[model samples]
Target: MPIDWSPLKEIIDQQNRFVLTSHVRPDADALGSELGMALLLRSLGKTVQIINPGATPAHLQFLDPDGEIKSVHDAPALKQAILECDVHIVLDTSAWGQLGEVGKLMQKSTTQKVVIDHHVSSDDLNAIQFKDTSSPATGCLVYDFTQAIDHTPSARAASCLYAAIATDTGWFRFPSTTSKTMRTIANLIDAGANPAELYTLLYEQAAVPRLHLSGIVLQRVATACHGQLAYTYVTQSDFARSKAHPADTENLVNQCMTIAGIRAAFILVQQPNRKYKVSLRSRVDFDVTPIAEQLGGGGHRQASGAMLPGPKDAALKKLIQLFEEELKKQPPAEKNH
Candidate 1:
C-alpha cells in the first residue's frame, strides 16, 4: 500500500523539536530537501535541527539559511540534539545503511523516525516511510509535504527546493524529469525562487580548480568496446595538483557520457586506505543499477555508484574487465535509430 502522509500533519503539529538529516555525500537534492523541510517546519513554530554526517560541499553552502546545519564530525552537540528531538526526518536517503553507523543511533533514539525520499530501493527504516520513486526529486516530496500543512513556502524554502529539483533533473535534461517537475519548478519560481541566482550559485560560481581537475580527468579518459563505454580515474596526485576536494568531482562521470558515441561512462576516485569510489552513468537504455548492486551499492538504472575495497589501479582494472564481460552479452548495436 502507498504511504499516506495525512497523519504526518498531526505528528508535525504536536512536535516541538524536529531533527532533519540526509544521505552521506549528499547531492543538492538531499541537502536542499532537508533544508527546505527544516525551514518550513520552523515556520510552523517547530524547533528544527538539521544534521548530516558529512560536511557540506562549498558549492552547496548557500542552501543553509543561518548556517544551522551541524556536521556530525565537528559538533558533539548533534548527539544530544538527536536524542532530545521529538521527531527525526531523513531525506533523500533510502536506507538506514545509507546513514552508515549513524543509523544505529537513530534506531536507539526515542524520537519518532520518519523518512521522506524518492529513491526506488530504500530499506524503509523509519516508523513512517514516505517514498515515491516516481517523484523527480525529494524536494518535490517536501513541497507536497509543505502544501499538506497549508504553509506557503518561504523564499529560502523555494530556493532550496528549486536547487534540489534543478540539479537532480540535470537542469531538466534527465529522463526522470516530467511535466510535474516543470509545474513544481514554476510554482517554486512564483513563490520567489530566483532561477538566475540558483544557476549562478550551482554552475556559474564553480571554482577554477574544479575545471582544471575536470580537464585533467578528461585528458586521461579511456574508451573500450568500440567507444561504447568510457572511464576516467582520479588519483591523490590529481587532487594535490588541482587543490580540489572529492566534492568537486561530483559530476565528472557525466562528462564522459557527453561524448556522442559513448553509451556509458565510469569514474573511479582513489580514496585513502587503498579504497576506490566508482560512479557510473548510462545514456541509452542500459541499466547501471545491476553493476552498482554487484558492488554492494544501489541507485537509479541510468546512474548509479559504488565503492570498491581495494587499490585504485587494481579496482579500475577489475571494473574495466567487468564492463567488457557485460558488453559481450549485449546484442550488436543497431545502425539506425
Candidate 2:
C-alpha cells in the first residue's frame, strides 16, 4: 500500500525543531535516511539535528564529511535537544531496543514521534508510521517523502540516499531490488549521485586492519546442519589480534553465504560486554526474521540480527540448534548433498 505522506507533510508544516535518529551501529540506510531527511527539513526552513546512539563506522565517515551526525554519548547536549525538539523522526529501524539510549528519551518525551522505516519487525512507537515492508530500503521511502512534497534533494543528499538504497539492495543484486528501486536510483543519479565514486568510498576504501579481520573471520567459517548452514565467529581476541574495530565485521556473514549449497549463514561477533551480535543472512525463500525475533531481534526476511549472551560455545550451540530446526522444515531437495 502506498503511504499517504500528506500527514507527515502537515506535521512538518506544524513543527519547527526536529531531531532525527536511527538504530545503534547504523548502516548506510540508517545514516543516509537521516541525512536525506535533515536536508529536506532544512530546505523547508525547519531546524534539524541528526543524532544517533552510536558513532558512524570509520568506513562510512565519507557520507557525512561535514560531521553533522552526532552521537548522543559523545555529546551531552543532544539529550537537551531531544527534549526540546518539537518532533522526533526515527529512520531505518523501528525497534526501541535498537535505539539504545535514544529510545529511553523517546519514551519519556511527550512530544510527537514519527517513524519512517522499511523493516518488517517493529514495536508500537505511538508515532505516525510511514512504513512499507515491500520497499527495498528506507532510502526509497525518504525519496518518496521528497516526491510527496515535490522537493528535490541536494546533490549530497542524493549521494547519501543513493548509498542507502544501493548498500541495502546489495548493489541492486538483492531480491528486494525492483524496477521501482532502479527508477529511484536513476532519479538520485539525475539529482547528482555518483554511483562509481560512492561504491569506491564504501567498498574499495577498506583498511588493512579490516582485511586482517576478514581473513581471521573467514578462516573460521564452518558448515553444519547437513552442510546447509554456514557460520563463523569473531571474538574480542580476534579483534585484538587483527587490530580491527567491530565495524570491520560488517558484511562478513554474507561472505559465508558465497559457499555453494549453503542455504543460510550467520556470524557472531562478540561485543565489548561479551554478548554476541548475531548477523543472519539467508536466501529469499528462507526467512531469517523468525530466528532473529526468537532471540529478541528483528529485521528483513533475508537479513536479520539478534544479540545473544555468550560464553561463546553456549551461544554457538544454541544458534546451531535453531538453524537445525529451521532447516529441517525445508524439503529434502533443499538440503545440501
Best by TM-score: 1
Clashes of each: 0, 0
Task: Give the winner by lDDT.
Answer: 2
Residues 1-337 of candidate 1: C-alpha lDDT, one tens digit per residue? 3447887887887779988888888889999998899888888888988888678876688787467877776667787788778998999986777775456678888679888988866377756888888887999999988776677899888999999999988899878888978988999999999999899988887788999999899899889878889999998889999998887898799888888788789999988665888998886557777788888987877788999976777887788787777667664467786
lDDT against true structure, model 2: 0.92
List TM-scores for all candidates, in order. Answer: 0.85, 0.83
- For every candidate in turn, the CA RMSD to the true structure comes to 3.2, 3.7
Model 2 misplaced stretches (Cα beyond 4 Å):
216-226, 232-242, 267-280, 287-325, 332-337
lDDT of 2 by residue, 123-165 (tens): 9688899999999999999999999899998998999999999
In candidate 1, the residue pairs with backbone N, CA or C atoms under 3 Å apart (3 or more residues apart, or in different chains) clash, namely: none
Candidate 2 residue-wise lDDT at 115:
97
